[model samples]
Target: MTRKLEGQITIITGGARGIGRGIAKRLAADGAQVIIWDIRPEYFDSVAAGFEPIDTMAVDVADPESVATAAQTVLTTYGAPSIVVNNAGINGPVVPVTDYDFETWRRVIQVNLDSVFLVSRAFVPAMVEKSYGRIVTVASIAGKEGVPGIAAYASAKAGAIGFTKSLAKELVTSGVTVNAVAPVMVETELLEQMTAEHIAASKAKIPMQRLLGIEELAAVVAFAASPECSCTTGFVFDASGGRATY
Candidate 1:
């Protein structure tokens, strides 16, 4: 059988590393033209080296102008992407809401919540015109449930879920699908910020008692961004290792 996304163009935000990197590589391996949009230019060369045939660009998803410029450059260069994965995010400082630094909270919301808005606003217009597109935002189980500390991160991700649902409904008649992926604590660079006790405790909550692998998460993402995903929209595919049972 032929590859599912052969010849399709996909733009992945924060594709330099972690789950985003896995999604990019998996999509490319499945024959999509992958464009990685990451803020750290220094990492591009290295990330590009890992995915030999993929493309890269510096994009600050939190900034509307930056996102617009990057989308334009991609369209001018590779045409409008059929698939967009809003996977950029950050785990803000771990603290109670009352003790949280306002700056850190704002930054978390900006990167996690505002960036999704910027990227979608900048690029979805073309998708709308074409009447075809796939949008998958990386959310978290924390979004569905309130976790102590990391108030901004959790709230932003929750907002992303809502955004996906609302947009999916709006575009239902069109050929566009919007969805989200909600994973539990995966063993990624982001986990380094959590205290050892917290990490262990979090792990204990999962019935599987293990952290999800990037490849595992990538598989879920690949399906959502594929043409095969026609029937599902505004849904959250869970990769929580049984940690989140809703």
Candidate 2:
């Protein structure tokens, strides 16, 4: 590896497993010091053993207080992070809007959408002070093209994309770049939350007729978080396997 991100400090929310784990490992390998913030830290030891050592903190990203506390810890322990990946999210029940539970819809939006706002608000000022940062949100293709049976998840992701655009513009002249990565179905434990039919339908929408690879998504995110990605901000990088156009 070229170590393009050498000495950079990075934070990845929901990095205990799945897509978040993949991105964390990739960033660490590229020489960034990675810290994981997940609601569950019991699995951190096992996951960290498989790759380079990564610091872990138990955090409920959806909680404003929790994000604030964790952000302070990161700032004190690792100094200001040059990279922040807002990847914590959930797939709400596979039910139609008419059948979806109102509370569950709210929960999904809080976790997937509000967490982004809270976490970014907590750390962005430090980045602005230093005049350098990379903020990447893991959105979904469903956000761009709504999918049936996952209204809550899709709506939250759409909010994420919108947030990315808005923040990018706000920091356009501050040496901080904000962007998003929209991927189609990926082979992650989150898939277990969806029905088999839903999974199949998502994969079929991709021209590749396959789910995305964890490392593949990590590679794209690594680029977006790197110093080389200087000219693009507020852009949604696609990892949809040809499923997204426009």
Candidate 3:
């Protein structure tokens, strides 16, 4: 069988584990040279061993300098990537906007929103020069509908959706496509970190009454990253398992 991503170079942020890791594995399996960027370097040994000379880099995506440095390193090693998955994110504290800590909100916005800007700023020129690229940002249902307690997370994801649409418009003439995938809730390690009450409440909101699987979401990521995604720019693909009505 022919690989869908043959000869494509892909970069995935927050790729050490969870949703990002799932995307990295899926893209690699589909024949893209995958770069896994995350803050943890220890998981690199195990994760890297699973693919063909998988590359790993440690960077906090929220920092512009860090993102630029990592992008440079990846470019030097693998040339300009044709595909990028802006998947790095943080689920900030569960609190109402008024009760939320300012510092925590800033951190969440920095990671989830600023990181996309930093990554796009650092790498989009190359994509433009090459005259071809695909960018898929991992957004969330919180972006579309306001969640009760995850104010920071919801705000940041909404920002990501806005950024994705804006960038898609800017790159419309070029042979580059930009889109975002918004998933409701996935059964990932990040969800485990949430308080049991928060998790229960989140599950209760989903019509499916269960968390989505990593592979299920990866399928959406894979499609948005495909070359066949010619006419679908500046769009949001909802994988909410019936949680999204709009």
Candidate 4:
């Protein structure tokens, strides 16, 4: 089979587990040299070992110094990335806005929104110089329709969608494609952070009557990260089963 990403250098953040890991596996299988960036170094060896030729780096995507240093290290070793997946995120604990923890809200925004800006800031210059790149950001359906309890998470994801659109436009003439995949409640460890009531409430909203599968969402990520996605940018691909009526 001819690989769409043959010899492509790909970077997947939070690739040690969950939806990020699914994206990493699919990208690596498609012949990209996948480099994973995750905060947990302990999971690196095992998670990377599952995919052929995939390497992992300990990176706190939200931290500017960590992102800059990690980007430098990755460039030195793997050259510039042709494909970038901004998948590192957290679904902050579910709580009503009145009772929400301020620090947790900040942390959620840091990981889910600020990291997108920081990662693009760190690596996109190289991509622009090369005049070629694919950027895929992981968003959420909650961003489209705000959920009641997870205000911080919903806000950050909405920001991610906006950021993807703005960046895509900026890179439209630069040979770089930026798009976002917004998935309805995918089955992942992040879901564990929510209360049972919250999880059930979210599922009830999905027209599919079920949570998305990780690989199912990864399929969209793979497409968005391929050179074949040439003409589309600033677009949000909804993988929310039948719930996305708009």
lDDT value, candidate 4, whole model: 0.90
Residues 208-244 of candidate 4 have per-residue lDDT tens digits of 8999999899999999999899999999999998998
lDDT of 1 at 140: 89
Please give, for residues 1-246, the per-residue lDDT of candidate 3 as tens digits: 778998798988888888887888788888888888888845755534466426778899999888889899888888889999999999988777789888888999999999999998788999999999999999999999978899889999999999999999999999999999999888987876688988888789888889889989999999999988888999999998898887
Across 1-246, the per-residue lDDT of candidate 1 in tens digits comes to 668899888999998887888888888888888888999744654544456545778888998889989989988888878999999999887789999989888899999989988887777888988988999999988899878877898999999999999989988978989999999888887888888877887788789989888889999999999999999999999999987778
Candidate 2: Cα lDDT at 79: 84
lDDT of 2 at 19: 89
Total clashing pairs for each candidate: 0, 0, 0, 0
What lDDT score goes with residue 205 in model 4?
88
Q: Name the TM-score of candidate 3.
A: 0.95
Better of 2 and 3 by lDDT: 2
Best model number under TM-score: 2
Pairwise TM-score winner, candidates 2 and 4: 2
Worst 10 residues of 1 by lDDT: 44-53
What's the TM for model 1? 0.95
Give the C-alpha miss distance for residue 63 in model 1, angstroms.
0.8
Cα-based lDDT for every prediction:
0.87, 0.91, 0.88, 0.90
List the candidate 1 regions with Cα displacement exceeding 4 Å.
Answer: 45-50
- For residue 1, what is the lDDT in candidate 2? 43
Best by lDDT: 2
| Candidate 3 error regions (>4 Å) | 45-49
